[model samples]
Target: MTQAPDKLVQSPVVPHIVTELPGPKARAHLEFDKLWTSPSVPRAYPVVPVRGEGCTIEDIDGNLFLDFNAGIAVTSTGHCNPKVVAAIQDQAGKLIHYSADFYIPLYAEMCAELSRIAPMKEKCRAFLGNSGTEAVEGAIKLARFATKRQNIVAFLGAFHGRTYGSVSLTASKAKYHAGFGPLLPGIYHAPFGHVADLKWFDEVLFKHLVPADEVAAIIVEPIQGEGGYLVPEDGFLQGLRKICDDNGILLISDEVQAGAGRTGKMWSIQNWDVEPDIIATAKGIASGMPLGAFIARESLMTKWGPGAHGTTYGGNPLACAAAIETIKQLEGGLMANATARGNQLMTGLREIQKKHPGLVKDVRGIGLMIGVEFDSHEHAAAVEWASFQRGVLALEAGMTVVRISPPLVITEAEAATGLRLFGEAVAEVAAKG
Candidate 1:
């Protein structure tokens, strides 16, 4: 039987569906979406969520769902968190934007907060931006300016951003680059999380393609985000650090998805005990507000003079305030909760994988960031669609991996309930097959 834990069942706000799929209101909203929204945005299912609290989402149609996607991992602290909202409100009422070109309290406060929690050993510096892609773009420019190099190495299945510079660094989907001709030059792609890839970087790219000194940085997502949520093999981060040191290349961790307490740490790379020179962050940084930052060691940042990189509204006061509160909330308790809930969810998924070997190829994750890969992309899509019907919200990553990055505030009972519904969805899909 599909059921929630007793505690969760007693809770009034957990995955309660009132209407059928895409009810009248949702259908109307979908039509409006089709007419007004850009076609580029890929939506898996029709769920016009009107409100959200913690890990729960309520569609305009009155269907409640467990929001496992968290708006593509952007709302890490959960939607409309009161603290974050209060911060945003207070900041907005006081000061909205004076352009980040000048000093501001929220900006200063956020910078200090980020530096305090930054993974860098020495004093760190931060350049604020407005999105994950902007952070990555800023990191790219910073790398070049700091190292005086031209070429950069990025992984093959990375989803950096949609901007020209970031998209050039992105090799996740061909569609991202379709007809976007002549992307930023001097960028190279390599296999992620593979030691051979690093060796090739040394033996081939460094030796033959581009000189090591000419390479600015090797950008990577410590845990591949859009790339199947694949965790690197043990020692991968350590090896990466060594490679960067040997080559005088900076190691840039694109932690836009894996950072901000998502991977049971302030930064996912912390699990490796290796420090990256620079880390780009966003997505979950501002609890859904448009905010991002590329933090680096002070020494690296000192190489570049002022005017080398700048943004007008990079550090929007409202976003910065919310981000600061988001950090505080995560540090308070959500980080630990994420670790425990992740264990619960992973255990359940592994059990389900064992039951449906043909459907689930693998189940793996750390913290609340998880992926369940099916035999084929079609099967994975079917399962996700089925889950949506069962009042669960999920997203797909890579070709055949379903990503589950729930809000960090999710309770253990809520996690169990989501997992149970997901298991039932998979069974339903298998039965249909």
Candidate 2:
């Protein structure tokens, strides 16, 4: 067992349940929510998470769930991390809001810190934004402006963001782009990893689809998060890097779900030696606060003038404070913890796969960013629902993949608990089949 740092704050006594989920109280709360909230974005889990600490979520109905989803991988430091909470509370008293034009100490420090710790630190400068979409938008703008080209290349099974500029670059599914019209022009799609033929990427994607002169940039995710935590082939990223370099196209890595110590490393690309020109990060940047950043070398970043881009609430003091402390905590041992925990999880899943071969086809991932691929979407949904019933909270990725990204601050014991519950759910579902 890996011992926790002495300074680490202890979690509260966990709650337990004696009744079914959504037991009366949660159902009533849902009724209230249905009246006030938009109908389009429906809630999945019946219980409303009221409070969270360490690796567990306590619901309004007093049911506790081992948090495997980690607020969709945003709260990597665990829920209400003490250092981050203290930073937020302290900053809230002094300053909460600031105009983008104003020179804020926290903002400057955050930018500096991100640049210092980023995988491509030697060639990075930070552009702070309010969300992942904003970071993607900034990357697109920078790529287009710097390269002086309009053609942008994205991979298949990619989910950049929901905004217009970012959405134009996303190629995962139709629904995300169905209703939207007149997306930014000259965007092209290429197959992700050349799964069928390894050489196809070099022969087709790089040489044919996106030719050198006309191409502006190639954007990719280190590990496809929303697209199913897909880890590309060994040399795929290095191949992309070479292609981008040969074509004078900038490579922008969308680490929105895989960065800020999610993949046991500060950045997922660290797993591969490939260095991208620009990197967009969010989700876990401020340990769940709305903070996004696009980083590039100072030379490439200088393409934008004063009025090139701006946002009303970008790099607010509260988020900056949270991010600063969050980064500080990640430096010591939390990142290594994620690596160790992830190995344990991957190994455990492999053992489960051997026991229930038909249910889980493949278990693949790095660090805590992992996915178990089921045979079909229906089976995946069944497993997810079963896990929910078993008091484990996990998320589905793509159509047939279950993502197991817990908070980095999760203990080895909590991981073992979640995995055991998940395995039980899988066994029950597989037996039915």
Candidate 3:
């Protein structure tokens, strides 16, 4: 019931193309980037962005695009949001960096904010970090430390992060582990999104591989990301909670992608009404700042002694300031906007799906975190490219799903326009197929 700020801007003319994609200037930048950047960087398309505002982006060329990707859902408030910018500017002038070893007022304030908003019933404490991977890694350490257990459980098709520990927990794709070998031991993968799968943890995993008593935690995405924007069937998350409770294991919700108002709630886990022992979040938490955190119950977090884990640049003041303002904006109705616009987009996509039943295999998700699945990866890639050509920026998730996650500030008109452009893209690709 929070009211949106009056400062929210009206929708602007978007998806405007003044030049070809990867135009002259963009091509130059791409060539320069290829020379200096690491080859591992995945460049989705050639739209070289220079700046962005609200739900719109402008490439190095004169072309404008309606950004449905939102920098992979990192920009929750919108690109260059004025309020967040003001907060960052103010904090930068006052203080920029302070190590975790010393007292940082902003860091304490940010943690307090996280505690207030955490989905857990008990009072919580937080450990801040620099990215989603770091958050997950911290959660892993906390789980193992608190439970005195070594084994961990994760889901197939879940992308936690790319760091050593987090990547070890990931099973979304094989290429992520192509060269990296001997991943962290005592980590097990379980089928995601079904009550029946929870039984496998007891019967198959515990009996055959690892014992339930040895498992430290079961880390899961409330709504799977990267693998696909897949929503679990009802009672699935509750089942996970029960399993954790019955086994004396901690329940860790990896909200790195689906948290921060993306799913019309403070955390995606809220949608399931299941309380997690720990929550790892990043991405949209700070409105594009390099900040992440793993929040746990007060009793559990207090058990860790000093110097057990720490970070230098994790709780930077600038990031904290931006995060405070971002949370305010979300509370001030960006979350509601996400719900409204998300419904509009989902409904429109389903209509488009009706036109090409064979091409679009499924349309599913909650709030603004949505996926349009195609019959094959090739068709999904084609539709994604076609959408890009039309100046609507979108990204692919899983092997054959196009993710639609735009800025929460996206207006109804903007979403409708995006849907129309997306529909055209799908039809174009469908005809070609």
Top candidate when judged by TM-score against the true structure:
3
Ranked by lDDT from best down, the candidates are 3, 1, 2
Q: Give the best candidate by lDDT.
A: 3
TM-score of structure candidate 3: 0.97
Q: What is the C-alpha RMSD of each candidate to the true structure, in Å?
A: 4.2, 4.6, 4.5
Error of 2 at 128 (Å): 0.9
Candidate 1 lDDT, 1-433, residue by residue in tens: 1222222222375788877897778887788778988898988888887777788887776678899999999898888898998989988799988987788877878888898999898999898989999999999998998888999999889989999999999999999999998999999998777665567777878778888889999898999999889998877778888988998999999999999999899899998888999999999989999999999999998888879898899989999998999999889988898899999999999999999999999998789999999999998999889999988899999999999999998888889999999999999988888
Positional deviation of residue 164's Cα in model 2 after best superposition, in angstroms: 0.6
Model 2 Cα displacement at 152 (Å)? 0.9
Q: What is the lDDT of residue 190 in candidate 1?
A: 81
> What's the lDDT for residue 289 in model 1?
94
Off by over 4 Å in 3: 1-12
For model 1, the stretches where C-alpha displacement exceeds 4 angstroms are 1-13
For model 3, what is the alpha-carbon lDDT of residue 387?
A: 95
Residue 112 shift from truth in candidate 1, angstroms: 1.2
- lDDT measured at residue 294 in model 2 versus the true structure, 0 to 100: 92
Better of 1 and 3 by lDDT: 3
Cα shift from native, residue 132, model 3 (Å): 0.3
